[model samples]
Target: MTETGDLSTAGAQNGHSCCAPATSRAEAVDSHVSHPGADPAVNSESEPEFSFDFVTAGGTFDMGDPFGDGHPADGEGPRHRVNLTEFEIATTSVTNDDFARFVADTGFVTTAERLGTSAVFAMLLETNPGAEAHILGQAPGVPWWVEVSGANWAAPEGPGSTIDNRRDHPVVHISWDDAQAYCAWSGTRLPSEAEWELAARGGLKGRRYPWGNRLLTDGEWNCNIWQGEFPRTNTLDDGFIGTAPARHFAPNGLGLFNTVGNVWEWCADWFTRDYYQHSPQSDPQGPDIGDKRIMRGGSFLCHDSYCNRYRVAARSSNTPDSSASNIGFRAVRKAH
Candidate 1:
């Protein structure tokens, strides 16, 4: 039930990936396709308007899995204490509507849009003959992930899919670089790993989830994670098959919505498994350099049978240019 190896390595070893497909930009490129350059826009001088609700959080908190149930290869154990200054974090992940506004204002093109393809859970695609045409190929080892051409945030499932009715849903197919672009344009930044954990913990000292140690409270699902067998069957016990609304689930004690499940939220940290071994006690800003970036808050695809990263202390990472249908991000800023 518990995941043992890192997602990137485990996927290759067992043919089952955790959370989402973790392909790098170099791995995404094909000899037949031409990739475009990233958007050149920078942060705007004017204050950008955001409709998101922000929750203020600050204090000393236990930062890792206190129960010692986390994946050792992921560096989720050896629970550490961290102190954070006052900061504001978005209550919900960035919605399609929110990302739309950012694109409208900055004309920023996400990495997926530029590359002309992105990783999408194959089950999300329509069961039609033409659906196969949009699929470029399947991710190595993770056959459930199909690299679909034109599978950007707007058309999450490929050419025919649209975000028209899912505006309230968290925007997916977002890479770390794409998230950074949105942060720059919004005059906000991605939450550091420490800040993110504090907000996710809500006011609790150390618990398995934002709500408590149990996955369910009174037989009721607390968040939007997979309820049935993963990669093959989802029982829809949480009222969602793919991504849920950005504000679908109950807020944590800190008023953060879907902080543990819904979609994987990117953090402003370069990922390193051993960082916790020598991390700073105050405001540890991940490692200085790394090929991958941190992603917290396991996605709707998380299932106890395979990926139990929905737990509050669970951690994972992906390449900065990796974009997937289950990946999204929230913004944060210094609180006055």
Candidate 2:
């Protein structure tokens, strides 16, 4: 993942791979479309009201890579124990309607909307080829991501797209600063990387996923993730291709929904690949200074063929001002 001064780049940057069965890819192309909008069966019901449904968590748990299968360059290894103070985290990510309310009350403008542009997936831009002419550029290495004018939180897929029926979906194209602004207005803050890991684990120990060792439970999908080819086709086997509702599936043991998938959630920490080497054992925040902010929980675009960072211990980062179609965040508060 290339890090530059540009603000229109896709915030999510990681390196990995995982592929579905070869047979699944061929069938996926025909059955799946470029976008995953509101599925009536998945989101016709309204989202749970944003009541700061916070889950209080505290104590020590193993943090970082446990399997040693993660990329060495990204620095996911030498798993260690991290102790944390009690804190309350929102049970779900901030939804579009939740952000709209914040904007209505504070008149705050997101970086994307202010810049009048943001990075959109190539698939979505396919429907409107003319948008390519308005392109600011492309994300380095990931050319499928095009930076287009007028692509913001309101018009996530660029022009002619709307969140009219996606009020329950997590708001995307939100930069780290935008998320921080919302947290400030709500009297909360984003969770530290350690705190986020603790809450995501849901009291489980050394589990690859939030629910446990298994990716699926009793033939039931636990999160919204890409089910077919990476970037090329999403089979939508989990019932979603893009962002899903904040409460699309059952919550973890701690009652946190979509903690490991749906969208990459921003965390409160300056990212450093080697920070874990000297991190504090007690309530460890991240590095004191860095070029990028940390982002966790892989998005619906994640696939095994490439970018399998959806695991509980995996992570990625982006410049604080960068925003994209598959990035969002949640808020937290220290318990008194």
Candidate 3:
């Protein structure tokens, strides 16, 4: 039930919670099981070939706390219990270079490419528009988030823009369909909701921050997020204004990098407001069909004053077909 946003531009400024019951999710998975058909887990057969870092997480854990402290309205209430089996997730969000190879081979056109442009937030001031650059914006990031024409993975800034210099940064302005396409080609799949949450938590039981509560230990910055005023001044405390490299920050207790900040990672689950009310206790997937798809890992823009969802447990969603400049994805798969 959290609002939609990018943690990078909006730092401390972004985006949801959803848990469904066991019976419902179980029924949905079973009814919709279709064929168990192609072992979605068997990437050994794909030509694109994907290799996962494969972090191993196990044991019982508290899924979500609706009535816990500072809980949001839509995330759920009365908290819940869930047990996750063994699983593996990518160490970082899919990078530009990583995605480029997929497109170069498949000629995959991203949603932003197909739609012309995605939502881009205007994050800079209008002063000294003539300083330097090759775009028509006054500040840094698009502050207004207008659907400018000709914006996509190739043209992140807009019309005349290009990803030539940003091949190292994570690919943004992508939709759920785009993410799925990449995963399909890469021989990997999106992490399930339970798998995503467990990975974000990094095996920590109740600590807020990934490294065990205490956002800062002895004045040292932990995650990569905004430190100064949002949407205007960033203070560059994290040495980054927008999306930092996927490996910018330290890894969680599980040794997984960028669990909280940098970019909101897309997961394999459709969104439902009341799903968490009765979410399953063990490896719950999600509702059958809903409007929005699930996204996790609050980005670099998370802040308490506005969007403090950078925490490992926070979540949000958007239309499956929707794409934005702030949103991106990583891939996950079962271990052999």
Between candidates 2 and 3, the TM-score winner: 2
Residue 234 lDDT (model 3)? 76
TM-score of 3: 0.79
In model 1, how large is the Cα lDDT of residue 199?
Answer: 90
Off by over 4 Å in 3: 1-52, 66-71, 124-143
Top candidate when judged by lDDT against the true structure: 1
lDDT of 2 by residue, 151-204 (tens): 888888787778888998999989887887777667678888988988999999
User: What's the TM-score of every candidate structure?
Assistant: 0.90, 0.84, 0.79
Q: Tell me which residue pairs clash in candidate 2.
A: 17-304, 18-304, 18-305, 19-305
RMSD of each: 6.2, 10.6, 7.4
Q: What is the C-alpha lDDT of each candidate?
A: 0.79, 0.74, 0.61
Residue-by-residue lDDT tens digits, candidate 1, 237-271: 88988888887778888888899888999987887
Report the Cα lDDT for residue 140, model 1. 60
Worst 10 residues of 1 by lDDT: 30-39
Top candidate on TM-score is: 1
